[model samples]
Target: MNRDSIFISHATPQDNEFSIWLTSRLEMLGYKVWIDKEGLLGGERFWVTIQQAIQSSAKVLFVYSKNIVTNEGILKQGIENEIEYAKSIALQFHIQDYIIPLHIDDSPYNLAIGLPNINHIPFNNNWAEGLKILKKKLEKDSIPQIFDTSKSVMAEWYENEYISNCSIIPKTELFYTSWWSVSDLPKEFYMYQFSNEVQAKAIRNSNQTIPVSLMSNVLSTFDAKLSFVVNRDDENIELKPVHTYIYSLNDILYGFESDKFPQHRDVENHFKRLLYRVVSNFLIYKGLWRNEMSNKRLAYFLPKYEKIKKIDFTYPYSNRKKSKSILGKFESIGMWHYAVSIQPMLFPFVGFSLKSHILFTSDGFKIIDDDKKQHSYRRKKGKRFFNEEWRDLLLAFLQRLKDDNEEIKIKVSQEGLVMKMKEWPEMFWSEVGYNDPNSKMDLDKIEDYYEEITEESND
Candidate 1:
């Protein structure tokens, strides 16, 4: 029997996914790895086999998580037995670093009783990054590898066990995207040349009123006339607007003939910046409150006003359909308000790409300013949302913005020009067969969380 094999000790079923993934990767690297996939049966013969395997192993990789221990600092019986046996073997053999702990979740290291004062490789945030560090440590420890024969064995095992579970079947699937297509847009682009730099600076400063892209003394916009009056020094200033140039949308999309913006990319970038401001202004006009992120980018969030408590929408779940509110109050973490950072895209499609964000508020009025706490709350609560949930949340938010005419229209110019988005674009793909088992589990948990919150709000 060879002592070159790497022994993997993990909590069964709960840590099986990570254990399997790690085993496959290590085996591919030509390291002989042993893992009991069926879990401990708790017999004398089983214990004897496990003890012999651990004793003859080069290093024992322990998968550490809350699954192997309780929140009250109690260790799992099977995991405790395995760790105790491995530690005894390490002491007898004088193995300096016998057990290498792989911390997969947010389980505190202090509570990991069996493996005390040992450094752990963090795989909580990113598995690939953790694997890189683990590989380097293995190489440093001079772990023996039988690359020639091990590769073939791993391929056969993977194909027989893993690939058997997945099947390639022909099916058509509809993918809901965050992209909302711009069906109609204004044709004309106006450049309002101010009298002096002072007037231009004032107009630039008050961008929320009339969205514009300022360059020197020139103010570029899609609107023919300014929506708000210009004032300076607490006095109304009568200013005359001199039209510099009226460029067509085609010129901005294709090429720019102007000397200032010579490059086509620069023209497109300028248009995108101006378009973002327009969309932000449109959201503000629609009564959505704006909150500026630390990066100086503005994110508009739905406020809990008297009229709007929750935005209702329907989404597919399991074999049936379900409806839920995109905005709600979670008892564990304040109010979860749906926020979006709209970015105007041109290459793939002429549309506004909405990036979803969650803003927290105590009473659904004032936003939580503690950045650290907000991040932690988002990680804890937002993890429950599956792809379907996120998609429907975005859909509901967009649906709420629609008028009675069933159109989301933004006024661009004073010349009655507007940009319209009828609805979200649904992309369909054929021959899709894969489905995530975890998503269904997550959806169930999230639904329960929603029910709990609803009950709390009622109380």
Candidate 2:
């Protein structure tokens, strides 16, 4: 009749020995331990008995092993369902760490069920030490701290009466309108990087940096607003006033991935998790634009993706609404040809073939006309980019596979796909010559052509 039973949730037979030993050890520490082996009789309903044991137990200990992670048979043994029910009960009571994970093997953290980030108590190397740690944790029932607010009845009343009744309609409406306003862009930014060492020296000599207004003005040329700016720390040595610009990379990436169903929080979380892996010498420019960079010349340069080679640089003419049908089709077809000509330097995948064509829409690039068979080539929508950790891991892994054999295939993990952005270093800084405001490429003429195209299309 012990109500303080600690339930051991594990795969039977495989984990049978460990469960038996753990039960005995916990019982020795003055705890009532419940295992399916001892709790259920022959005639008992299997599910009802499990539910009752789980309900009666104060804590659920998930026993993790190598077998549990890889063996499908073990998962089919009904322990996953028990974990699910335990999670449900924990959620109902608003519990934290109600189900503790104990590890008996060195499986990857991501492999453990319902415990990706949680630090599990390791019993792999030293069982006695892990048991001691568990004993200490369970000494006081592991109750979460709750602040007593019995004397704050008036405080609660004030919040309920004033804050709850406050009208936030105007603020909420303003947010929606502001988002759409920034989102509506007439031109795409086509960024280009320059290691223009000559220009770098000139900036250093002048002891001056690009004006803060430069970024906004450049964005406005395309009728776009500032989205996210990743500043280079060492650039402060040169003191670029433009580096002061700061916005959430998470928000910008989510807007790119999905206009209909954006996972804002997920984007935020992944960026935060992988922020430390980013080196200090890089910058990212994100905003509402049809292209990655513009024809306007500028001083600052965006970082280049060192890994990718022969990226498709051309974009759809900004004023597509005004272009003649023949001209538009020609331009679009030209872009598709350019896209097909490019090849991935790091990951070799046959993308632009005879059957498939790359289409440049207003928002971003798409590879279509192949019955959606280009999943391997394109980044899945809603995935954030610039994951340094994942990229490093994948490259190393791929190289290892290549070393083993000439042609080998391996299953792609979620981490690999999540960091797979379609085209990285998507925008480059508007590169120009030293002391000359204009570059050798003549961006002004390019701009003029776009203007003329727009006018003709309008006519």
Runs of candidate 1 exceeding 4 Å displacement: 28-30, 40-45, 69-74, 106-114, 117-137, 145-168, 195-197, 204-208, 227-229, 233-236, 250-269, 284-310, 314-339, 356-390, 413-417, 426-459
Error of 2 at 283 (Å): 68
- lDDT string, candidate 1, 291-320, tens digits: 888778778887777644555444432354
lDDT of 2 by residue, 93-134 (tens): 776777888997666666545588766988765455567667
Q: Where's the lowest-lDDT run of ten residues in candidate 2?
A: 172-181
Query: What is the Å distance of residue 132 in model 2 from its true position?
Result: 0.4
Supply the TM-score for candidate 1.
0.72
Model 2 CA deviation exceeding 4 Å by range? 1-3, 38-45, 69-74, 140-459
